[model samples]
Target: MEKKVFLLPFASVILLLHYWVTCLTLAVSLTNLSDEYALLALKAHITYDSQGILATNWSSTTSYCNWFGVSCNAHHGRLTALNLSNMGLEGTIPPQVSNLSFLASLDLSDNYFHASLPNEIGNCRQLRQLYFFNNELTGSIPQSLGNLSKLEESYLDSNHLTGDIPEEMSNLLSLKILSLFVNNLTGSIPSGIFNISSLQSISLSANDLYGNLPMDMCDRIPNLNGLYLSYNQLSGQIPTSLHNCAKLQLISLSYNEFIGSIPKGIGNLSELEVLYLGQKHLTGEIPEALFNISSLRIFDLPSNNLSGTLPSSMCCNLPSLEVISLSWNQLKGKIPSSLSHCQELRTLSLSFNQFTGSIPLGIGNLSKLEELYLGINNLTEYGSEGIVSTSDVYSNGIMLLEVFARKKPTDEMFVGDPTLKSWVESLASTVMEFVDTNLLDKEDEHFAIKENCVLCIMALALECTAESPEDRINMRDVVARLKKIRIKLLM
Candidate 1:
C-alpha cells in the first residue's frame, strides 16, 4: 500500500511538470508574434499600467480568442477573424499578424493606420476577405499578396497607395470584388486582371491609370455587375465587346479621354440602372437604343459633343429615370412633352443648347421635379393660337419679371411711358388709389408704415422713370408700395 501511494504522488508530479513545460512553450511562441516595436507605437496612443502593459484587465496568455475584436474556432482554439474597423487605431500594421496562420478575415478600415502594408501579411494564406480602406496607408501594394490564393474580396480604396497595382494580384483567381479607387496608383492597368471569371465588381476610379482599357474586360468577367473607371486618363473608344456583359448593372466612365461615338449596343445591358459617361470626348448623336433601356435610373452624358434632336420617345419608355443630364451638348429641337411621363424625375438639365419652341406645359405635371436648368437656350412660348410668341398664362410671374427687368429695360406694355410729366401724375393717382383701397384697410391698423413711407415711395417712382419711356414704373408701383409698407413694419 505504501508503494502504491508513492507511485500516485510521482505520477501527479510528472503531470504538473508537463503542464508547466507546455505553457512555457506557448508563451515563448506568442512572444515572437507580439511585435514589440508595433506594440510600443500602439501604446504611445494609449494609457498603460505600471507594468508597461495596455490598461486593460483581460488576460492575454489564457486564450487570444477572448481578445478584443477576435473570434476563434471553439474546437481548435485557433483565431479565425479579427475585426478592428473604426477603432481609431493609429500606427503601422505589425508584422506579428503573420502568426495567425489560420486567420481567414481581417478588417481594419476607417482607421488611421499608416506606412506600407507589412510583408508578413502573405503568411495569412487562408485569408478570404481583407478590408483596409479609408486609411492613411502609403507605399506600393505588396506583391506577396499573391499568396492569398483564396481571397474573394479586397478593398484598399481611399488610401495614399501609389505605384502600379501589383501584377501578382492576377493570381487571386477566386477574387469577386476588388476596389482600389481614390488612390494615387499610376501606370497602365494590368492586362487580364479582369480575365478572372469570378470577378463580380471592380472599382478603380479617381486614379492616374493611362492606356486603352482591356478589350476583353467585360467578356472575360462574365459575372461583373458594377464597373467604375471614372476620372482616369484612359484613352480609346469604349470597348464594343462590353455589350456581352448581360449582368452589368452600373457603369461610370466619366471624366476620361475616351474618344468615339457611344456604342449603340449599350442597350443590351438590360440590367443597367446607372450609366455615367459625361465629360468625355465622345461625339455623334446619342443612340436611340439608350432610350429603350427600361432599367435606366441615372443617365448622365453632360459636356460632350453629342448633336441632333433628342428622340421624342426617349423618356416615353424609361419610366424609371430619376436624374437625366444631357446639358452642354449640341442637341436641338423642343423639349419632349412625353418627359412628363417620367413620374420619378428629380433633376433634368438640358441647358446650353439650341432647342426651340415652347416649354412643355406637361413639365409642370412632374411633381417630383426639384431642379430644372433650361438656360442659354432658344425656348420661346407658344400663344393660344399656336403662334410662336412669349405669351403663356404662367409666362411672366413676379420672379421672372424681376429677373428680366434687371437684365434689360422693360417695354411700354409692361412699364408705362415716362417722357410725359402728365403720364407720371396719372400713374401716381392710380397707384395711390390701389394702395389706399387694397392695402390701408382698418384691419391693418396694427401694421402701420413708417414716417418716411411716402418719401421713399415717391423717390422710388421718380428714379424708376428717369431712364427712358420703356423704363418707367407701370403696375410695379403698387407692388413697390406694398413691399415698402411691409419693410417699414418689420423695421
Candidate 2:
C-alpha cells in the first residue's frame, strides 16, 4: 500500500514537469512569431521598392530568417541584423520594428526613407550600429534613441533632419563615430558629448549649430582623428584644449563666426594633414610652428583679420603641402621666397592683403602651380637686380592714381584742370610738378624712370576710361597686358 502511494505522487510530478515544458516552448514560438510579424509590417510600410528586392523575396512562403536583407541568430532564431543600404528602397520605419528585441545592427542608408524615425526602435536594447545617412529622412531625431546605450556607431548624415541633437545622446558610452553632417540641426552642442572618451570621429559640419565648443573639448577624446564643424553659425573663441587630441588628422572649422587667434598649440598635432580655419574673425599672427608639421597637405586660413609677416622658412619642412590660401587678411611684409620649396603646391592665393615688397622671383619655378592669385595688394613685380621693375611700379601707380582720382575728383588741386581724364593724359611729362616736393627729396636723379612708369599708367588709365565702355579693355585683358608689360621690362 505504501509503494502504490509513492508511485501516484511520482506520476503527478512527471505530468507537472511536462506541462511547464510545453508552456515554455509555446512562449518561445510566440516570440519568434512576433518577430516575423514585425518584419512583415516593415514590408507593408514600404511604398516603393525600385529593385523589387523586398517585394519578391520577403514572401510569406519562406521563413523570415531567409528573407532578403534580414538576418537571424542561429542559436535563438531571432532577428539580429537588417541591412537594406543602397537598394533603392523607399519606406517609413514602422513602430512594429520594436518587436525585434535581439536586433543588433540596422542600415537603410542611401535610399528614400522619409518621416521621423520611429521612437519604438529604442526598444531594441541590443542595437549596436545604426546607419540612416544619405536619405530624405526629415523631422527631429527621436529622443528615445538615447536608450540605445550599446550603440557604437551612428551615421545620420546627409539627411534633411531638423531640430537640436538630443542631449540624452551622451548616454551612449560605447559610441565611436557620430556623424550628423549636412543636416539642419541647430543649438549648442551638448557638452557631455565631448566627455565620451570612446569617440574617434565626430562630424557635425554643414549644420546651423551655434555656440562655443566646450572648454574641455578633446580632453576626453584622446583618439579623436577627425573633427568637422564647418558652415555653422557657431561663435566664441575656439577651445584651446583642441590640441589635446594628439591623433587628430583632419580639423575643418571654416565658414563660422569664431573670433579668436588660431591656437598656437595646434602646431603640436604631428599627424594633422588638413587644417581649414577660414572666413572668420580670427586675429593675431600666423603661428610659425604650423610650418613644422610636415604631414600638412591643405592649409587654408583666408578672409580673416590675421596680421604680421609670414616666417621666412614657412615651407621648409612641409614636403606634402599642396594648397596654401591666406587671402583677404591684414598680413604684411614681403612674399617669402621659401614658398617655392613646396614642390607639391598646386594652388597659392594671397590676394587683397596689406602685403608689400616685390614678388618672389622663384615663384615662376613651381611647375605644379595651377592657380596663383596676387591681386589687390601692394605687391610689385620682382626685378633681376632686386630694384622694383619699372612696369611693376606702373601697375602699382595706376591702382593708387585711380583711387585718388575717384576719391578727390573735385579737390582744389584740380581746380584749373578741365577733368581728371585730361590731367592723367599729361601725367607723364608734368608728373614731377603735381607731387609734393618732400616725396622727391631723397632721389631726384631717377626722373626718366619715373616718367616712363607714369606714361605707361597714363595710357592704361586712358584706355580704361574710354568714352565707350565697349571700346575699353576687359579686366582679364588688362591683367594680361600688365603681365606682358612686366615681362618686357624684365627683358
Most accurate candidate by lDDT: 2
Q: Per-residue error at 112 for model 1, in Å?
A: 0.8
- Give me candidate 2's TM-score against the actual structure: 0.75
lDDT of 1 by residue, 37-155 (tens): 33333445433234322345234454555656667777655667877788666767767677667778889898888889988788889899999999999999998887889999999
- Clash count list over all predictions: 0, 0
Q: Which pairs of residues clash in candidate 2, taking residues 3 or more apart in a chain or in different chains?
A: none
List TM-scores for all candidates, in order.
0.70, 0.75
**For model 2, how does the per-residue alpha-carbon lDDT over 1-491 read when each residue is reduced to its tens digit?**
55553355878999999999999999989999999999999899999999998888988898989998889999989999999999988889999999899999999999999998998988888999999999999999888888999999999999999999999898888999999999999998888898889999999999999998876687878889999898899889887887899999999888899998998889999999999888649999988889999999988888789999999899889989988888768989988989879999876767668888878867767779754556588876446535323333333333434343431222223335554456756654666544434433336576555455545655675675555546665666667776765665555
Query: What's the residue-level lDDT of 329 in candidate 1?
Result: 79
User: Which structure among the candidates has the greatest TM-score?
Assistant: 2
Native-to-model Cα distance after best TM-score fit, residue 210 in candidate 2, in Å: 1.3
